[model samples]
Target: MQPILSLDGVAKSYGGVKALTSGALDLYCGQVTALLGENGAGKSTLVKIITGIVHADGGTITLDGKPVVIESAEHARSLGISAIFQEPVVFDALTVAENIFITGRPLKGRSVDWPTMMRRSREILAELDPSIDPAMVLGRLSVAQRHLVQIARALSNDARIVIMDEPTAALSHREAEELFAITRRLRDEGRAILFISHKFEEVFALCDRYAVFRDGAGVGQGTLQGMSSERLITLMVGRPVDQVFPKQVVAIGEEVLRVEALGRCLEYENVSFDVRRGEILGVYGLIGAGRSEVMHALFGTAPAETGRIVLNGETVSIRSAQQAIAHGIGLVPEDRQRQGAHLRLAIGDNITLPSLGRTTRGGFLSARREREQAAPLAEQLGVKMSGLRQRVEDLSGGNQQKVVIAKWLATAPRVLILDEPTKGIDVGAKAQVHRLMGELAAKGVAIIMVSSELPEVLGMADRIMVMRRGLVQGIVPRSEATPERIVKMATDA
Candidate 1:
């Protein structure tokens, strides 16, 4: 069967660097195609080209057996192409109906037809999710609901080729299931869909076909039937990933930090745990379980209303992040893009931002000192970059995460907190991050890892702390921890 949309030898370059050397993809009506790749594999570039965010330097795009050039985002929309990002782009101040028709509203004799617009919005939303109110303010809706509104917009535009770019990245498991339902509905309606994700489970569960990109080129594409994840990994990185979680054995030493009875109103309560030298204490829980909230409190970003922190056997009050850093603590937050890295800053600058005191002479910043400090950390973390002068925004997701870790490492904190450290990265990058955690633990840096992936926590953590509904269920040692036991502890009352 012929594909509804097909691209041959699509390529894009930037200032002498090729972002996409040879991109290829096919989206068929009534099917979901999984775009699989490691970071920097040109998937983003290909998506941009298709969506008209960037024009390809070399390639042929065919729609319904005819060649075409997608000139801009508006043009792409007009051509029945629409993309829904992880974070739905909608105006918070606008009503759901207003946002649905923001691009083009119904008009009766020059003036806007409010009743017609509202009716159309309700009709579109009813198809996706009838519970959503067309008259409700967009900001008042949950993340999942906002995504539904975005889909409604796509439907309103009569989009036939829809691209979902990590749509479940910010969603809960239940919400993701709901999205999968919506996706199937779209496919059944004879619309072609492209699903871009880092999750193998999600890909295998929802996609009917597969396409893999590596090193800026499309290396493989085939049906998902009879395809093992191992084969897919091999195709993505050009080699077998023997171990995605390379956890190394390290000696557990004296306790370095402890929290007792930590509590925050409506967030978390009575959370208590301790991390020792050369120990990896993994915190596991479902979404909204308060795992991150406790970490935020410990890091002083969100101080607990009721609790006492003991650092090296001494009680201390950490009311701010600076205080936490001064107390020899560092936290790599879950949302790296918004909370961890300075996107516009140079790599060297971001690395040394937390330790500017050491990189300054006579209250003045020293670029040489900053470079001297950042270079080794970047190299140690194996951050792939042209130079220290390169902006953090230009690096891949994996490299950007490494930069965040390196930034915290520069502080030389006795205790390190990593929240979803490997989230959204591919198998290759996940392994690297795990390896780094092992190395850090071996060097006697007390580590606390907060992760949602069960295998990752079980593989790397020396001890696991389970949280449920803002409360600690239990803390199980690695030897005693099993998937069933942990899941029960997290979900069971």
Candidate 2:
């Protein structure tokens, strides 16, 4: 079968730095083709080249077996190609109807045609979701709803090839399911879907074919039916990873953190859990189960109004993150892009930011000490980078995560809080992170991990604590932490 779109020898460079050496892909109608790679492996560059955001240094693009020149984003849109980014690029000021019809609102003799636009918007959106009101402001909708509007706009524009870049990165499990269903509908309608993501489970579940890129080159491309997840990881990383989860059993010691009836009105109430030295306690729950909220209170992101937090047998009141740090607590938030790391800063700076006091002498910061303190952690975590001066934002998703973990580890806290540590990373990276966690546990650093992936909880956690409506449903050992038991615990009151 002829491909609807194909790229031959697609190459790109920036300031003499080659971003892509030989990028290539083929998108066929009625198929979801996954673009797989590490964060800096040239997947985004290829996407940008196809979307006309950046001009390729050298390549031939054939659409329907005919050579075509795409000069700009508008040109790509005109050719029935549209992209929905990780964060939906929608106009917050405009209503849902206006956003869907922004490309070409129905014109009426030099006047805006609001009625026709609304009707058309409603019609297109009805296919995906009928509950959304076309007249509602785009900013008023939830994150998932905003994504739906983006999809509706692509469909309304008569897009034949749609690109989804990490569509489920921020969505909950339930929301991701909805997006997956809509993607299937588009595939059934004969539209070519290009799905780019880091989650192995999602790629295996949603994609029919895959094009794998590694170090700015295409390594493999084929149907998903016969491929194993390990092979896919190897292709993405150019290495044979032994195990994705390197869990190590350590002797659990004295309790490092003791929370007594931690409660915040309307969010969570009477939540209590204990973490022992060298142990990882995994927090499992559905959305609104108050998992993150509990962590927030524990780490002083959002303090609990009523609770007694005892660290090392000393009752301490942590009113801010600074105080928490003073009490030897560290937290790596779920949203690494926002709360965890400073994107514009270099790796050394980000890692040593929290431990600046240690790197200072007589009220002056020591660059040598900063490097000495951060270099080992980065090396131990196997952070891939050209130099310590490289910006954190330029690294791949997995490397960026490594930088985040390095920052917290530099503090050398007795207790570490990891919220969704491997949210948007490849399988190999996930394995590396799991190994790091196991190593940390062996070093006697108590870890509190909050995650939605049941398998991850079952794999790495010493104890699984299921939360429901701001309460602890049950705490079970690893031997008893089955999916059925966890699900039941999460759903039960």
Candidate 3:
């Protein structure tokens, strides 16, 4: 069967650096192709080329068995191509109907046909999700509903080739399932879909074919049938990942942090756990299970309404972040882009932000002292960058995560709370993070890691704490923990 869209030897270069050396892909009608790659592996470049955001320097793009040069976004849209990003790019101030027809609205005799526009929006939204009202304001809808509106817009434009880039990154499990259902519907409707994601589970569940890219070149492509995740990882990184977890056994020491009967109204309650020196305590739970809420409470970002926090065998009251920091506690939040790091700030500045007191002299901040303090942390975390002056926004997802970790490490905290530390990073980055966690544990830093991935929790934690609906289900040692047991404990009513 011939592909509806195909690329051969696609190449792009910025100045002297090559972004894509020999990119290639094929999108067939009635199928979802998974675009798998590590961060900065030319996946974004390929998407931009296809969407006409940037023209490829070298390559042959074929559509309908004929070579084509997509000149602009308008031209790509005209050719039935549309892209839905992780964050829906729509005006929240506009109504659902207005957003659906923002680019082109119905007009009757030079006057905008409001009734016709509303009717068409209703028809499109009804096909995707009948529960969504066309007259509702876009801002009032949930993130998942906004995504449905984006899909409605694509259908309104008669898009035949749709690209979904990390569409489920910000969604809950149920929301992701809903998106998957819509994806299958689009495929059944004879649309060629390109799905780009870091999640292997989603790839296996929703995609029929796979394409792997590494170092700006296509390394592998074939049907997803009979393909193991290990094989796919090897293809993406160009080597066998013998130890994806790489958890190191460190000498467990005395208890460093303890919580007794921690509770917060409408969030979490009666959460109690203790982390020993040089121990990794993995917190596992489903979404809204209050795993992150407990972490936030411990970090004093949101103080627990009822509980006792014991640090080094001494009960302490931590009602603010400053008090938590003073008590030698640190937290790496789940949403790194929003809460963990300063995106627009320089890497050195962000790292030193938590430890500004040490970087100041004579009641003034010193750049020399700041670099002296942050440079070593960045290097220790293996943060790849042009220079210390470079902004954190310019780094890849993996490197940005490292920067966030570095920022917290600078605080010299005895207890570190990591909320979804490897949430959106690639396999290589995940291994690096696991290794760092091992190193930190070896240094006798008590760590509490909140993760949604079962394998990660099992691999990295010396002990696992399971939570369900703002309550502690059970705590199991690593030696006795199994996937089935953990899942049962987390999901059981």
Q: lDDT per residue, candidate 3, 369-416, as tens digits? A: 998999999998889999899999999999999999999999999999
- RMSD, each candidate, Å? 2.3, 2.4, 1.4
lDDT per residue (tens digit) for residues 1-493 in model 1: 9999999899999998899999999999999999999888899999999999999999899999899999999999999999999889999999999999888899999999999999999889888889888999899999999999889989989999999999999898789999999999999999999999988879988999999999899999979999998899899988765667778888899999989999999999998889999999999999999999999898899999998999999999999999999999999999998999999999999999999999999999999999899999999988999999999999888899999999999999899999999998877888889999999999999999999888889989999999999999999999999999999998893
| TM of each candidate vs. truth | 0.92, 0.92, 0.97
Error of 1 at 98 (Å): 2.8
Flag clash pairs in model 1.
none
Tally clashing residue pairs in candidate 1: 0
- Single out the weakest 10-residue window by summed lDDT for candidate 3: 237-246
The CA lDDT at 442 in model 1 is 96
Tens-place lDDT digits, model 2, residues 145-204: 999999999988899999999999778778999999999999999999999987778888
What are the clash counts of all predictions, listed in order?
Answer: 0, 0, 0
Model 1: lDDT to the true structure: 0.93
Model 3 scores a TM of: 0.97
